[model samples]
Target: MPSRAPDDIERAHLRDPNDRRFTIARRLPPEPLRAWLRRFWIPVWDVPDGESAAQRVLQYPVCLSITTPGYSRFVGPNPGLSTTVLEGRSWGFGTMFAPAAGAVLSPGTLRDLAGTHCDLEQIPALAGLTEPVRVLMAEDPSAEETHAACCALVEERLERLGVPGEEDLLINAIVEEVEGDSSLLTVGQLGERFGLGERSLQRLVSRRLGLTPAWLIRRRRLHEAAGALRGTEELAELAARLGYADQSHFTHDFRTSTGSTPGEFARRWRDES
Candidate 1:
């Protein structure tokens, strides 16, 4: 298990500092696979006999490959928040694919799979990964050797997909730029920076990530808010900094996506911590 303080973790995850039901660890893909693979994640969990814990994520706009004891599948971009309930003792081995990998992995257009997932066995090219990863995670869910073996298996499979092309790399750049820079507030600003017109940028993101540029921006803002609210920052000041028109608009956006007001969320996080 990786020993990371809750406050130091990635903002995309909505983690409770007091929750001890699960542990997560991350490993980077080797250099050659970086163009297609982001990183590998292994999460092992144990809950009391009759209770359950819910894990939430503000997912990135990319595809995912996950294998657990009972299932193996490819997950498309999630349009909003993602939640999974956990019980008993178990583990999951997952690959967070880069933006460029969606086109190569999807049997049809990536757009068709948004907000959904497909079984790995349903896709012939990736079917080889299903059984091997399942067996490894089931046999030794917590060993470093087991995790390394899983990554080696995936590396072999993804290497056959070949190198990402120029357009594929461009899409990667576009997505990274949006997530990395907070000052990029509008789609027009994004397009101007990339030398792409509005329509062209829209079509490109739709084709590769199965998401609109506008939605991506909104999601980033919410993720930032989720992290910031853990502190003592004033709501109005936080809203202004994140480019929201007003605090009312900020509260509405946060509640719409998270089912909790910004103030409510901040209080809950503080109470737990």
Candidate 2:
């Protein structure tokens, strides 16, 4: 995959400026794990007592997160933006799984988890790994140590479950194609390009990802739009570029997903900086 250039407006998608109470760091897993793992992300936050900050995200297609003082859980894809409020001092380490990789650790289809979370220990494949991880996390390990521990745990689980199957690879490819290509404007376009009928495409995504193809496409487009809003582009042009019919349509969708209009979002980033 081509790396994003420094000036690429899409880089803003990786972060949010509305909340400055935390720092996030990411590390790639070992090469052998790249097919099923995207990266391990650690977020460390320190806030004054009685105050809180809201962290919002245009989350990826799927994730399996482990948090300190919280249960390890598998989070499926959500159709809209997700937000969490942070208070006091806190930290969390999470693995952003490839679209189909979650299925390997899940007891049922990914659709069952869509827009929801389940305790990771409930999954037979992940049952025994959480306790050791909890012990390691309690000691406040360094980033490198945490990454190594997570990699090792995942490796052990993969050994027992076997490598992700062909279906996983197929789902990963479809997600990558849509995410990497901005020209893919609609689910129908994706269906045609992937050579699957619209209904079949929806079924495949629902079964493996627990999300509708339309939701996936809309989420990707909204992510791009949110990123571009942090830059200087005109709303109409950005909306058209993202395949919206007009500026009004884009504004409505953007506000609905992010709770702020494009202009207000950009201005907040500008004023914050």
Candidate 3:
């Protein structure tokens, strides 16, 4: 019989990351993040509740996103990094797509990319996805190498769409915002800073980044709150800093977006910590 697959590796659309929730001690190393998934998409089963699934994908600065077959044939705003779990039945391999400059739009009112398995040239309205894309994914080359290559090719195409001479600035600004306050900064605020009107900024952000500025900021804040939950920061205090008017409000939003309340998240995190 073929040697048992390594524990670190698993077959497609099978394994679940939901049974157990895990927290990274630090930022997930980019090397590993960029490397192929040794197993199927791990679900973040503990986001807003008892368990969500080990699968979580997000786009940060310019709407960095992680996708699976689950997002296929779907549209509409995803809440909380838009945490979505996808199975190989629709798509395979957990892939991460980062925006280098512009925005990425979900194929709203369009068919899922998995349906056609189309090559780059055949992909419809891809220009509407985003600009300056950097996609990374790994799969058994012998079995699904073609899809893997397709992802890479798509990344190259998107990368070419980065905003002219503004990729670096946009990335830095978003990162800074995420790293800074958790205040209730509105879309208009984000747009004004970019020297664009609210609607214009929204269009730019949606077109190039694939998400609204609000989603990006909210997700980052939630991630930070999750990180801070186990630290010295007071629970009530942290929630406020993240722009939650009160603990209940923060708890509700966190659970809605992440699938777990702040107290529960911290408790689980403490167990893990």
Candidate 4:
């Protein structure tokens, strides 16, 4: 089984650490499903009347989530930060999908869903599981029970669809390699390492993930940089570690993706903390 520790780089993206409005728990699924499922997450929140807390996250590659008294949806890769306001009392359970798992879960190509959220009922393969999922989550079961129920639902879906193909595994492997190595700064470099021609690599990723190899590499660097901003003031060193040419280049990309300079973001987080 994969390690259960949360991605430390992702944890740094939280909008507020001082706000005591909610709690989140994450667990690994059973061994059979790990190839397709990243982790199961449950977030429970209660806000005082007339007061609301906003939770912000730099979403993982992809996700399928069900909110209580709410809706069930599959969210594609979001290029920017995603934020939701919490009011009253509410909870949600979500399945974080592996990068290429969408190929098996969606009837259409993943490109169609990029930067968008689709209702689970709209997808043929996942539609049947929607209502049963709602009933199981509505009962407010314990974490262990919730994990078991979700695992069963996913297992059934995989069984019906059959196992993922080699193309799916190839796409996933590419994503894993980029995420694991910061030195891979460009799609050309990534292709060389994987022994694929640049255009072939691009075509493969675009077909399966609806995203380019460059986008995946840049997003991973930005996510790690966002996490480091809170702890380090040496922007140049941070940029070097993230494989950027220099601080200026890193600043440009960070502002483009996050809408704020690293220094400004760090200052705001510090003030709030």
Best by lDDT: 1
RMSD of 1: 2.5
lDDT for predicted candidate 3 compared with the true structure: 0.43
Q: Report the Cα lDDT for residue 121, model 4.
A: 78
Query: In candidate 3, residue 25 scores what lDDT?
Result: 13
Q: What ranking of all candidate models by lDDT puts the best one first?
A: 1, 4, 2, 3
Ten contiguous residues minimizing lDDT sum, candidate 3:
33-42
Q: What's the CA error at residue 198 for candidate 2, in Å?
A: 1.2
Please give me the total number of clashing residue pairs in predicted model 2: 1
Q: Which stretches of candidate 4 lie over 4 Å from their true place?
A: 1-9, 141-143, 268-273
Report clash pairs, candidate 4: none
lDDT by residue (1-273, candidate 3, tens digit) is: 011123321111112333334321111112222221111222222244433344543323322233332332212233333344422222232333334222223433212221122222223434322222223222322233333344444444444444434554464455455446565457766666667687876665555445566766776676677667656688788877877788888888877765667777567546655
Ranking by TM-score: 1, 2, 4, 3
- The lDDT for every candidate, in the order shown, is 0.86, 0.73, 0.43, 0.74
Query: What TM-score, computed on C-alpha atoms, does each candidate reach?
Result: 0.94, 0.89, 0.51, 0.87
TM-score of 3: 0.51
- Pairs with backbone N, CA or C atoms under 3 Å apart (clashes), candidate 2: 111-210
